[model samples]
Target: MKIEVTHPEPKPGEPVGAQYWRSLDEYADRPEFKEWMHREFPQGASELDGVNRRHFLKIMAASFAVAGVGLTGCRRPESYILPFSKQPEGSIPGLPVYFSSSMPDGWDNLPLVVETHQHRPTHLEGNPLYQPYGSGLTAQASASVLDLYDPDRMTSSYRGTRRITSAQVRDLLQETADKFAPTRGQGLRFW
Candidate 1:
């Protein structure tokens, strides 16, 4: 069935982003509005109409699917626990560990270090040996340690598949470098 829609034009001198709506009684009395409302949403004596049932079923199915996903995610997986094979020399089991490092954000580079405890980065401090900002840490530099240890960073690295070992990656890189050495101007150079 063909549906017709009618909207009143804005009057002159009316402000922008302003809308005009007629009263329910006036809208019901208008033939064009009545036809439009009937075509868009058909009212029934009871709630068990075909169109209403289809819409209700679609909503219920979506809600059930979301609930099922939530329920499945509620159980913790065994692989979430990661224990270190060997702890570092200066690292304590539950204490924070700090290391000096240089971080460049945009054109400016800052020399700072952070203290991380139990996999969560807790605090940040400026490097004493740095020239310009010696032993003084900014708020942004301090907060950057939290960003480094964010859960989103872990999720991005380990989203779909298991991680590969660094040794396996280094061996693959060495093999590829050997194969491409000839093409990289070692003996294949024109001049």
Candidate 2:
């Protein structure tokens, strides 16, 4: 058997050759040609004939499995919508609403205002009715909201050795006052 190769070039004033080989090197050096040869006649591993097909199929199957897993994982969680029992007169759901209130912390009772969205207080602003201490809500008032929400506040207000209610605290104050009332003229030391 014998094999021959040919090269062709376009002539002057003629349409350029759409496809032609310039040299045997051009055909042999092509990446697609090399890849096709590798797929058709792989060297040094005859067992790869069966393994390569199985490997290509396994890779494609795994790619589809990963794509399906990713799509199923992207599903969003379910959300529940609960309306307020008594919605405020001017408040609307999904809209920012402001309310005028006073922060009774002796630091300018400016109309402490807060912005609420969907019945949740999302932000706080200083009441302009009081003195303007620069811009938005003061650090103390902002921190007070965190303090109010803290679980430790109730635990910190207990009397030594005993947990007493507000009424019990008032009675204890009255008893201490009665004991001190009789000795008003005496110079007593607090220590």
Candidate 3:
């Protein structure tokens, strides 16, 4: 049931000044507000409709039964943490390996020194040896290494909603190139 509350109005000759009021009901001293404040909770706050003790017990019993079955069924997947039989040629177990590389931009490349731990690229820095583009990397180049390990990075090409293999993609590109070969890609649009 919706409770109707009315605002208190000032008398005609009463002085109306800036007053700090917490709530309209408290400021107006309404009977409904007084009744609500006297109770620990608002009406029906602690009530559950149509959920008796028997129904609640049945739900709890079913939940426990399902949980017991799940717990019994679950076993840790078989896995072995084996050390490498032969260490990589130039790798030391604890030492990070650095490789000089370049990040391709449109018409230019950003020289980079990539640091890897266990063959995974962990960090990237400017290639100090490259004289022309000094030992300084752009922000994009610095953070580009993250893309290598990104879990959501696309690993396969897709045509609409269907996944297509690399070989199929290559063949399709070749066929398109052959189709545009006579015109020398005159009608081709990159976008």
Candidate 4:
């Protein structure tokens, strides 16, 4: 059904105030305007003429089942855990071991308990058994173990522009020790 619409014209002497009319359709007050107001959406927007919701859902479910079956062979391979054939003397996989140690500071020593995991020193704490030094570690002593794994630390000795082996460095140290032995470490300065 078609409805006719007409636009209202204001008189020459009257002014078109702000509250005169909201919209042209409302001012015209046609049957088509009332039908448009009663609808939830515009024409052809809410119309599902071809495939209804039930058929659409069944097609989606079948597509999902086929896709799932095709992806079954694409799963990750299974991984197995194996135990070590022969374990090392004092190394364990997860547990840490603690050993009593001392940190030398000038004339005295600070008692410490060194914690090691897989034979590698991981942490250091104060020894409570030693009464002379209280059960608290100095900041310097606590952080000293971390220097063992520092990335920038020198891994090998160097003499001038040439790389030196451990044996060469040991020989040079023995020579220094022999020279200082006569003086009883008098002239040998340690920083």
Per-residue accuracy of model 3 over 32-69 as CA lDDT, tens digit each: 99898888588977565789878989999999999998
Q: Model 4, residue 152: displacement in angstroms?
A: 1.3
Evaluate all candidate structures by whole-model CA lDDT and list the values in order: 0.71, 0.70, 0.87, 0.86
Q: TM-score for every candidate vs. truth?
A: 0.36, 0.35, 0.44, 0.44
| Whole-model alpha-carbon lDDT for candidate 2 | 0.70
Q: Is candidate 1 or candidate 4 better by lDDT?
A: 4
lDDT of 4 by residue, 10-59 (tens): 88878777767668997998889888878858886776679788998999
Expressed as tens digits, the lDDT of each residue in 1-191 for candidate 2 is 78787656667788764768766756668887676567665554555554687798898999999998899678688999887788768887777988776576664454578777765665678866655554367677776656655786776346787788888888977877777889973654332
**What are the clashing pairs of model 3?**
none
Candidate achieving higher lDDT, 1 or 2: 1
| Model 1 residue 175 lDDT score | 75
